[model samples]
Target: MLAPVLRKIIQNKTVMIERYLPSKGNLFVQKGDILEPFQKLGDCMHSPNTVYFPKEFEPVKFLREKVYFQKGSLIGKIGAKKVTADENGYMSFDEVSGEYFYEDMPVKFTLLSGLWGEVSDVIPESSVLIKTVVAEVDLVACTPNFSFGELVVFPNPTEILEKFYLESFVKSTEGKIVYVGHYADLDTIKKARDLKISAIVAGSADPVGFSFAKSANIGLGVVSGFGKLETPDFVYKLFNSVAYRHVFFHGDLGVLRIPMSGVEEETVSSKKKKTPLKVIKKVTKGQKVQVLQKPHFGKIGTIDRVSVSSIFVRFDNELGPVEIDLPNFFIIE
Candidate 1:
């Protein structure tokens, strides 16, 4: 009998997506419109923050209720204490304290589409729904976050991410999604945040560091068990193949998304066909698995027998089958 596949999470290639703006804005794309990566979708004008000046300035000279001044123009001085308009905007005087308050003019902002897709619906001045095809990879653990950027993979998947290697990419990794290697410690996690990286993917992360990343609002993903573990070859190959492409990290859902172009037919067809459900079954002989403990850690073996919580596995290097606990082995797909 065949051993059933466990945790067979479905990774959809063509996914329906909806992106909401921070606030209501002018929507540019309508239904049936196609969108490319980073295409402008909506925009709005936002007011600059208000700046409060000290009450020392002479309020009588600027008490016109609304006085517009050029950026960097001096408003007034109070005995060698010069108060300048940091930005071009109107100012109002406080009658009680005589402090000059400056409010800058509104600034225009544009929101990008961030993915390739077909516009499915338009929520006026708020959000847009689209259908897009992508490559997906399942992760073992991740914090909640959504991010899109070019994927940059590390050269080695077994090496621990050190401060030196991360410092090398400090300048170039800003606003980009970076993939550190197999293991990441607190030092590596802190450096990534300092570099202003949009997100990071790794094989395994320290539990404490993982919590810190979540608190700091930095995106992090792990594809293997906790502690120092090498990323599975299957997952590593998938990420490496899609290098430099625009990818999305659905950290809450534990999936990585890689957008693809020029395959509309396949993408649409795949969406129409429903995926088969994964069912649990009894473990049987000849089932392949990856060992998760030392002495046999990182080794692939075949099941020789199933007895209670202990499973007997036959590794190629061992003279006889060895017994392993349930939590120490995962069936290879």
Candidate 2:
């Protein structure tokens, strides 16, 4: 019998799916079997399929490698991190002995079912200790869905190479990306970031250029515009520029349950011409309008009722919700 459950659970692992239908309550067991429900059925054989062994889930890691920014060595020591839980059900960390925590401690909702048992009592920060544990867990819940799986596609070598430039080879040993992008000031970066320009190919970046990137949540690529630029010099400069990595770590960790509102399509009226539900309008606003890019990618919140140009946008991209300067942006089509 065909079963989607078996196929979805064991994405990579081989499995034999058996089915017996007729007013049964979802789960069924073999007549002569004595093993538990989640236990493997057999030697992966087919037939009456006395049991079912769902496929095993293999994880995919997604990371952008070959950073352009540079000079990212740690001057101080990273003390032992105290992993603990907070009231908001989040994994957090504080320095134990030293005074600083390692900047890149891998945050976000990653599946660890096969690795850890049912996560229960969480210390203040997730890196700390697990206080409680549920005896046994349903493997189904532990299995990551296609959505979460897409979050981290394993980094391919080619993917790594594309992130770096010609004159610059990137290294990420001490939890930081070092690079040398060519730019003048914060406004220059703002202009470049708006254009989605990866590198600023020019002169020495203004001293405050790094600060601008940090504030705007943008990464400065070490461009070749600066005369006689090399990897080491770039890395050192970008390193002292920003004290911490630009990774955003927020919210709960155990079973990251966000509203999985999938991809949505909408249209806006060129003028007052209404069609379906176009959540918000932007790129250009009238005297009264607000537009925003949001924590939810592709999702836009509109303030049409109160004013115009007041909208928020969210994309699945790492940039989170971008506060598009509505007056400065425009609709292409």
Candidate 3:
């Protein structure tokens, strides 16, 4: 009985943390060092520098020739226009496609510890594994990527992330993981990226905008299912409770992790004391659930009865109980 309940606990005792070195170099900390979210972990030298210019240029020679260009020197010609080197850099050409790209001089790169954890193991100069306690919120949908930053909250989830709201918080959003309210569209997402926001959390988003987040490589996590849904009150409260804390958004794993702080320990303890309820559990009377259908999509309600193939739900929106089929409701686990 407890095994099924334990499965509902999305967060566990330990997290596997990975930090990448741009190139192999010195590992700053050895195994067993306690790490903070922003501590320097390692450093590397001679990281690749890639420059992509407009597609109008036509190269005179292929990159297989391994040519070098001086600063402010002409490298290619686009009809009457000459393409000159912006800086002293090596040039490599893709002979197969007849395309060339300029590579700037490599520079030193520093790697930072992304979360509060203990170094469980070290892979020499390459990477390290860290283990720590965390609280995770499962995202309904998300883009695949990893990001970490201080969590910033917006006051209202009903208001769409419009231009003015973002403009008001431009300074606060820079390099931070911002929680944009319900239903962010493409324009808002583009504006946030322009501001260099590290990541975005929202209740729901349009499919086109969500796809753009994926293509742009912006970290995004959707709390509720997509399309115009206001974030549920419970989820909003959870975010507010952890505002200003550092969070890790692991989109590929569908979890937004809030590493346990002293204040968070009490909250975690209280949750553990409560009986765990799972979304995949067999429907039982009086179980609270979120409805996922027309006229009640994203609304929370209570289970009234369970049949062979359908369960009756008493929604906050409806006057009487309504019948819904299996998999159409998610328990508020």
Q: How does each model score on lDDT?
A: 0.75, 0.25, 0.75
Put down candidate 3 lDDT per residue, 173-258, tens digits, no spaces.
88788888877778878988999898898878889999999999998888776877666666678788878888888898988887
Tens-digit per-residue lDDT, 1-333, candidate 2:
110111100011111112222121222223333332223222211112111111221112212231111124322211433222121111112234322222222223221211111222222212211111111101111112111111111111132332333213222212222222322345545554554433322223444665566555544433221222212222233233322222111111112111110111012122322223233332322222212122222221322222254333333333543454434322211
Candidate with more favorable, higher TM-score: 1 or 2: 1
Kindly list the per-residue Cα lDDT of model 1 for residues 1-333, writing each as its tens digit: 334353422446469878767656798989999999789899877654787676566643747587888988888777788778778888887678666777788688677777788999999999899898765667778889998778888765334435556777778888788888777777788888999888988878889999999999999988765777666665676678767777889987888877766563354344223377545456778876777777777666789998877789998679999988877777764
Candidate 3, residue 314: how far the Cα is off, in Å: 9.9
lDDT of 2 at 201: 23
Order the candidates by TM-score, highest first — what do you get?
3, 1, 2
Clashes of each: 0, 59, 1
**Deviating ranges (above 4 Å) for candidate 1:** 1-9, 45-108, 157-162, 262-274, 279-288, 298-327
What ranges in model 3 sit over 4 Å off?
1-9, 46-49, 52-99, 104-108, 157-161, 169-176, 196-198, 244-246, 269-277, 280-288, 293-296, 301-329
